[model samples]
Target: MLDPELVERITARRAELDELEEQLAEQLAEVRAERDELAVAERVLERIARQLAE
Candidate 1:
């Protein structure tokens, strides 16, 4: 059987990992949103440039 202290340590580590995972997920979402916005801006800029060149 596992010792009580070891079990407690395992539980604590799991909680810490869960919190870290949540934080990383949120950051990933923010990064994706920024990337999408940049892509849209790039498209607009290209369109304007083409219009000006014509």
Candidate 2:
């Protein structure tokens, strides 16, 4: 038998944590997209250099 106030507090904290988790997930996705874009740029540069060498 839990106190109603305590249960309410716990529920509030869980919601806050859920929001933070969603924000972190979004940030992670942004970082991964940036990394992928950089990788693609590097490959393009390498290909251009190789073409100039021929």
TM-score of every model versus the real structure: 0.97, 0.90
3 Cα displacement, candidate 1 (Å): 0.6
Cα RMSD for candidates in order: 0.5, 0.8
| Weakest 10 consecutive residues of candidate 2 by summed lDDT | 1-10
lDDT tens digits, residue span 1-54, model 2 = 989999999999999999999999999999999999999999999999999999
Model 1, span 1-54: residue lDDT tens: 999999999999999999999999999999999999999999999999999999
Q: 34 in model 2: Cα distance from truth in Å?
A: 0.6
Off by over 4 Å in 2: none
